[model samples]
Target: METRPRGRDGTGVTNTDAGPGLVEPVPGYRTRVVDEGARDGPAVVLLHGTPLDLRAWDPLVPALRATRRVVRFDARGHGVAEDVPVPDVGRLAADVVAVLDHLGVADAHVVGHSWGGEIAQRVAVEHPGRVARLSLVCTRASPFPPFGELAASLRGGTVDLEALLGRWFTPAERAEPAGAAATVRAWLRDADRERWAEALDMIATFDGLADLAAVAAPADVVVAELDAVATPAHMAEIARTLPDAACHVLPGARHLAPLQHADAIARVLLA
Candidate 1:
């Protein structure tokens, strides 16, 4: 395993030397498993969203590791797994399944943020046997009204990545923006523009409203009170769809609530 500076968390990121355990070829991508805590503990899978990588969960992983085996990996177009094409929601969920199968994990508590949440929901719907529980943070049940426009705009030209980051973090977070910027830069460095555009296209065209009612897993829907990306109403709607889901709104947080309120999210997920 190799180690590298992953910002202020003190814990150096662990690179899986031989790639995560998997039977079939993942086509263009590789997987890395960051094994933490007891090997026999409950498995918890963490998935990050667009413009960010696995490191986005750095602050929360340690907290979660105290009681469970926290597994975090970069999405196909996002981190170390940079070779896979940007995929639709179903394919994204399949990627999660592939990771679990590779690691010999039968079932796990799945936690996802933003677009990652969409993938998580699909996993619960399509591959229900593999997901033990679900946690959706700053995510929506279906494609938002403005997603098409946003995807078009992103495809048109270069995006002001800094401005996008500014909108996600609170004023206090913006005070020390280096940490967040570095995370975003790492994702950008790993992702191709065409792949990112394709991912956005998939997101814009996705429709999951009809399938949400079939989800039977226990779920927790977390929303940031000040989130501009996925509004609180969207989070509430997601909670409403699941038969056994509950909602929690984090005060004084923006779209990046999972990062700002990592402890709280970890506590809820572990509980």
Candidate 2:
């Protein structure tokens, strides 16, 4: 049975394509993909973060799908893991291309959040022709420092999830029963521990600051004013590195902007 994707209301969102289904972008690596929205609109491919699945972008879908062909899928190892290699930033970017090839989409606007944003950068830099534009939310182009210690804690089964959640969102957002913070908490709580740890290790090894110059796509950098990890200044610095990019800062926002500021982000993507 498929896990129905719910909206902010807790009841599931309308399955514009009868809900997400399994598709093998690569043989034996079945991925849960949701391909819906306006059939003739420009393609928009959404990539999710490390601990989250396709649902991380759910809140923004309705707004985009009104006039866009929206495609989102679980990262290779998340959701229904099958025959696949260990997760990493580069391999994860390959999965993005595989999905586009499987869908026969020549190019699309790629949007990614957090770890997903890292994958977006890889796609733009390596497979430049496949990306028309980029929307990077709460992300960075440099090596993330804390992942080393975070990976260690994950390996030791000592990650303070509650504290992690606090960093991800504010108390008010977390208190909302069907809001982003709570939903993220559910995802964090249910994540496969070893895979999560391995993914973090992969992230710790990533160093993309030098590669930004190769990304030729027109891009938008979206960051939260209050996000400690992906700070506004850091995100702005990344924007400066890009050949053509604009930075937008959400006042007092935190890490998960898709869920926290979906409408605002949707406007940026559409603009």
lDDT digits (tens) for residues 1-271 of candidate 2: 1243554444443333744366778776886777899879999999877777787787899899979999998886566552244566777889899988987899999999988899999999889999999989998777776887897898798999989998977677678877666777777877777777666666677678779888889999998998887888889898988989988888878888887799889989999
Candidate 1, residue 4: the lDDT equals: 29
Q: Evaluated with TM-score, which candidate comes out highest?
A: 2
lDDT (Cα, tens digit) per residue for candidate 1, span 1-271 = 0112342333443443233322232666664456456568889999887756677888888787767887877787665555567766788899888888877889999998987888888999999999999999987766665656655666776566556667875455556636654555445545566657666666676678668789888999888899876788877877887889989888877887776788888778877
TM-score to native of every candidate shown: 0.86, 0.91
Worst 10 residues of 1 by lDDT: 1-10
- Where does model 1 exceed 4 Å of error? 1-13, 16-25, 170-172, 175-177, 185-191
Clashes of each: 1, 0
RMSD of 2: 3.4
Candidate 2, pairs of clashing residues: none
Query: Judged by lDDT against the true structure, how good is candidate 1?
Result: 0.73
RMSD of each: 3.9, 3.4
